[model samples]
Target: MDTLLSSIEMLARWDVMAALFIGSIGGVLVGAMPGVGAAVAIAIVLPVTFALEPIVGLTALLGIYGSSMFGGAIPAILVNTPGTPVNALTTYDGYPMTQRGEARRALSLAYSASFYGAVFSIVALMLLAPFLAKVAPMFGAREIFLAALLGIVLVIVTHRGQVLPAAILACLGIFLQTIGIESTAYTQRFTFGQPWLQSGVDLIVVVLGLFAISQALVLLMGRDKANDLPPVAKIGFFSQMKDLWLYRRVATVASSFGVICGMIPGVGEFMSQFMSYAYAQRSSKTPELFGKGNPEGIVASEAANNSVPAAAMIPLLALGIPGEELTAMMLAVFYVHNVIPGPQLFTQHMDFIYALYLCLFLLNVIVVAFLFFATRTLMKVMLIPNRFLGIMILTFSLIGVYTLRNSMTDVAIASAFGFFGFILKRLDLPTSPIILGIVLGKLMEDRLRTAMARVREPLDFIDRPIAFILFLMIVLAIAGQVWTVVKSRPNRKGTSHD
Candidate 1:
């Protein structure tokens, strides 16, 4: 009770409120742009924050971090483009829903779920910071490998009927990741003597190509125009609140997974999103509805991704660890303020800690409020002409992919992948597992190599209890999926579902 009072009192200050308002708006716009994420937003504002008090600066940055995940879904829903790479899963159902003229429903579900997930993580962070921090170090290379493996398995399961094609694309993605020089051998495997390929492919470039650019090509070839889009429903701001209430369990489980995964250093939003979506599909009665405009899919992906931002702070606040790039940037700000985050931070800067939590909570509220009121206007995006929108998206794709590395080679890669993605789409192949593979493959390979190097025997990595349990879980998941296919064979015999 005392803690709550102090936090509320601290958050009521004028400077903090002002900063949060501005930061939340800035974050939404930044996140709505493809390729611009929270890290970039924070970096842009960090310079200005140097003149303000530590609390104010930190509050603003937290606002950006908290709201960006929800904002990323805006583009994913209205267009077939993901503003942030983590929003790729959101695109699976979000864009399909948009095509069905359920943009309002999709946006509302994303907003509500994001707010709920952010709040859940904040509460968890307030209560379990120390405990989670202590447990975080237990996740070494072996555990990380398991987490990556689980993600791959779940993604494969997401495409139940197209498992073979998805697995092939996934393998291709992994092969693409191996294009650069081999780490241990110091020799190139697929670079083919090209100096540009030595650095490997960038995730952002691939994401833009896969979702944004390929989508533009489809729009160009299609007969439909943007103005031909279905009219937005006249549902009020809270009309979809019932759907959110109905899926409370999905939100809770995904949020819990987010917090748990986020607490581990270097495990970012992708793992949580993949794991939560897989879990939601595994448990859902209408599992077939996923990837075809299901609200639950949006809820699961948005909630899990949003939950990660706050839970990510747990390790940063409690153990002085930066879980990912965004937290690493926050660490720089903390050091500038002479605020060392460790065991002493809680005792020495209790007010700041409480204030930070309060600010994060309020940031979510501010973003939700802004989005709710502005949703109708945002949905008007669907009314734009497809030709113009396609051109704009193509331009955005080119610029975003190029700016990430400023290399002509990267631009070429984006164009090539854009074509490849379109071909896969025509073939009815799932591109998501490929993107997932590209994202997780490097981490998996690096971790497994490190764990193997340290252990004398191959099985030593699985000797630990955590690793052993994860291995069993993987086996069970695979077996369960196989059984599901075998059992459904009778039903699918004549229909030939794929």
Candidate 2:
């Protein structure tokens, strides 16, 4: 109780409140505007936050991460376009509701369901805090290495359709992390004797290029499409709140699904959305109503979507492992602030964790209330042309990257990655694995190097309890993926012959 009170007192400052407010508004606008995702927004804003207090910076990012999905549902419903990538499933039913003149209803349900999911996930995580404190200390070097290895394997196998491509990109990201001289050996691995290459690649630089710049180019150069928003009925936002009770079970189940996927090392929102949306349909008596404006679908997708951001924090804070890209970016924040997450944090700085939880809780209230009154105003953001938004994003990159390193070389590196990102997007390749591979790759390398000295053989890598369990899971996941691929090959081959 004393700890909780102190956390609240710590947040009772002007800067913290301001960060929350500004981040909330920024998140809504980003979500209302198509193609401006939270990752790019975080990447652009990350440099600026380095100057602020650590708690304040994290609060701001949390605001954006927690609230954007609510805003994303707006474009999904009104324009049949997802403002954020996770919102793609929302359009399946949300847009249909709009076409039937129930836009306000769809928006309300999304907002409410999102609120429920975020709250539920945060509460669940809080309950797990004691458990995590007990468990985090058990991670030895071998266990940590095995966990990172499992993460790499999960990254490779989890992409249902692009397993090969994701594996290749994951390897590439792991390789990129090896550019500088190794830490213990002081050996140059990939520098090739170039003085400038000694620093290797910056994660922020890559993020700026791939998410910020490449996305800008895609918006700048790609043909713009017309978005005709359907007519909305005369309905107050509060009117739909009553309808949400009808789908409470669906929302609860979806939120559970979100927590499960978010806790997983490599799986994120899409997987949760897929699982929850499917479960909702399968359980519903009117399963056929799903793809045609069913309120249940919106609830399932948004509830699961919002739940993930908080739940994804579990592994990150507990074990020092980032499960996905957003957390990876935030991990950089922790490192930048000289605040390491994991066992030490779990045991010593429990108050920091509590403060973050409060921020997330308050963020939901602020964003939901803001969306209630400001959604129509926020949707106007989408009216700005992609070319203009793209230009602004580039301008942001120039300012942000310059602020980061004060070097034009970083900008050039970002440009290279931006082009690479555009090419990956054009090829429909996944980008998350690349980032994950980089983050976990370093962990695997350091831990593996340490474990190597203590080990007798390769089998000894999984000698410990946690290490053995993780290794088994990795093997099972890989086997399952292979079996799936082999099972589906004959069908594709038969289709080609036909």
Candidate 3:
């Protein structure tokens, strides 16, 4: 009760309110732009925060971090473009909903679920962060390898019918990740003697190409088709609220997974969203509804991704260890403010910690408020001509990719991948698994190699209970996929005969 009172008192300050408001708007704008994510937004604002009081500055930064997460969903749903890479899962069902004239419903569900999920995670961070942090270090190299392997397996399973093609793309992604210098040896592996390839491909460049640029190319090729806005029902905000309330189970489960994943070092929002969506699909009553405008899919993806930004702060605050890239940036902000995070943080800065929690909760409320009031204006974006919209997306993609490293080689890599992504799209192969491969492959390789170096035997990983459980989960996932395929064969044959 004292903590709650202190947080409420801290939040009542005018400067804090103004800071959060401005930061929220900036975050939404930055997040709505492709390739510019929370990391970029926060990094840009980090220097500015040094001039303000600690509560005010940290609250502003937190606002940007939390709001930008849901901001990414805006472009994702309307344009099949993810504003942030983590939002790639949103496109699977969100874009389909827009095509079916349910953009408002999709957006509502995404924002609402995102808010609720963040609430869950923030509460968990307040209550369980310390305990979770103590256990986090127990996740060794072998355990990390198993977790990443599970991520790869779950991503492959997301492609229901195109398993083989998805596997191939995943392998290609892994292969691409190996193009730069080897992490351990520092020697070049696949650079082909080119200086540009020495540093390897950037994930942001690949993500922009795979999602934003390739989507633009598809639009350009289909330029003759008019961008038509379908008629939408006059659904009230309360109606949308009711819909989201019905999916509370999904939001809860996904948020829980997000918190757990956030406690593990090196695991990003991608794995959390991927695993959540997979779990939702398997547990859903209408499993076929996924990837086809299912509200549950949006709920799972948005809730899981949004849940991550706050939950990620857990390891940072409790253990002085960054959970992912974005949190690493936040750690810098902490240092700038002369605030040291660790077990002593609660004792040394209890007020700031509780205020941080409250600030995060309010950030969600503010973003949702902006969305509600601006929905009609924002929805007009869907009516823009495809040619102009496509050109804008391509421009953003190129600029976003180029600005990352200021190298033409990066631009070329993105362009090449854009064309390749279009080709893969035409072939009906899933590109997401490729992304999963690139993102998780390097981590899995480093961890597996480290684990192997530590042990003399091949079966040593199973000696650790957590590693053993993760391996068992991987085997179960494979077995489940096989069973699903076998179960579908008879039904497929019956339909063919009929």
Candidate 4:
């Protein structure tokens, strides 16, 4: 009760409220653009956060995180191009609904589901984070090592069809993450006599390269013709509310899945949205209508994507382990304020922590209200020419990458990754697992080494129940991949019979 009261009191302050408002607007703009995601947006703004009060910094970042989820849905509904990968599932139903003259209904369903999912996850974060914090300290080197392994396995398994390519990319990402000076041994793995490489590749540069610059190159190559979006009709809020209530069960299930997936490390919003969409398809009465404007599909995708920002914070706040790249950046913000996350954060910085809860609650309300009023204008951005959008993305990617360290070397790195990203996209490879691996690699390596060093025999590290369980999961994931590949192979006997 006291914590809640303190948070409410802190939120009533003007600076925090102003930060939230500005951050919300910025988040929406960034998210509406092709290829710009919340991670890139937050990364570009990280240096600015270093100058602000801890509460203010957190409030701003939270606004960006929450609003970006809804913002991504805008492009998906209007243009059939998802602004972020998390919104990819939204396009499966949202764009089709727009083509069917149900644009207003689709947009409305997305907004409502996003609003509800965000608010529900925030509530869960507030209620559960403190208890989880208390339990986190009990996790030692062995447990942490196993948890990291589980995260890697989850990413590989979730990629499904392209598991081998994903695994290769993941290995490459892990190798890249080891380029910087080692925290434990102070040994540099791949600095190669370059002073700039010693600090390693910036997360912002990599994300901008992979998502923004790569997308711009693709758009530019295909800019010979212009593509336009359908006209969206204005619909009443009550009508949209009716639609939402009609598909309440789907929304609930998707939101639940989002919270669960978000709580796990490495498996973030995209997986949640994908899983929810699949689950909805399997259970829907009108499953065949899913890609043809089904309201249930919209509910599943939007709810799951929006729920992730709040729930993804669970691991970060409780265990100092980020569930995804965005939350990992948020951890950097926490460090800037001289506030360490994990078990000590709650007891040491109670007011700031609780205030974050309040900020998240208010952010959802503000984004929904803002979107309701600006839907008409926001939807029009989708009609912009691909060429112009490409130029804008390139400009921002340059600016965003440069802003990270004001170094030309970072820009060069961005270009390199951009080229690699374009090739991966053309090949139908999954990039999410690679990003996940890069984000978790250092932590996984450190924990594994620490756990091994604690035992007389390295294999004895798996004697713990947690380690054994995680090892079994890794085995299962590999087996599942093998089975899938075997099943997909053509049998000579069957081919002859045919």
For each candidate in the order shown, give its overall lDDT on alpha carbons. Answer: 0.76, 0.87, 0.76, 0.78
Clashes of 4: 0
Among these predictions, the greatest TM-score belongs to 2
Residue lDDT tens for model 2, 84-174: 9999999999999888878888988898899899999999998988898889888878888778788788877888788999999999989
lDDT of 3 by residue, 442-481 (tens): 6678777889978877688778888889899899989998
Write one digit per residue (lDDT tens) for candidate 1, span 1-498.
Answer: 676687778788899899999888778866775555665466446545656788888888888888777678888887777767788999999989998878888888998899889999989888864564455556678776776677677667656578888778778777878888888889887888888889887665666677667767866776554333344554455776777998999999999999988876555688889999999999999999999998889999999999998877775675565555566556656766787665566655666787888888888888888888775565454444556656766777787666655788888998888898788868877776666676567657877887887789868878988789878878987899889988887764468547
Note the residue pairs that clash in candidate 2: none
* Model 2 deviation from native, Cα RMSD in Å: 2.1
Q: Which residues of candidate 1, in runs, are more than 4 Å off?
A: 1-114, 125-128, 223-363, 491-498
Q: What's each prediction's TM-score?
A: 0.61, 0.96, 0.63, 0.87
Rank order (by lDDT, best first): 2, 4, 1, 3
Each model's total of backbone clashes:
1, 0, 0, 0
User: Model 3 misses residue 91 by how many Å?
Assistant: 14
Q: Sort by TM-score, best first.
A: 2, 4, 3, 1
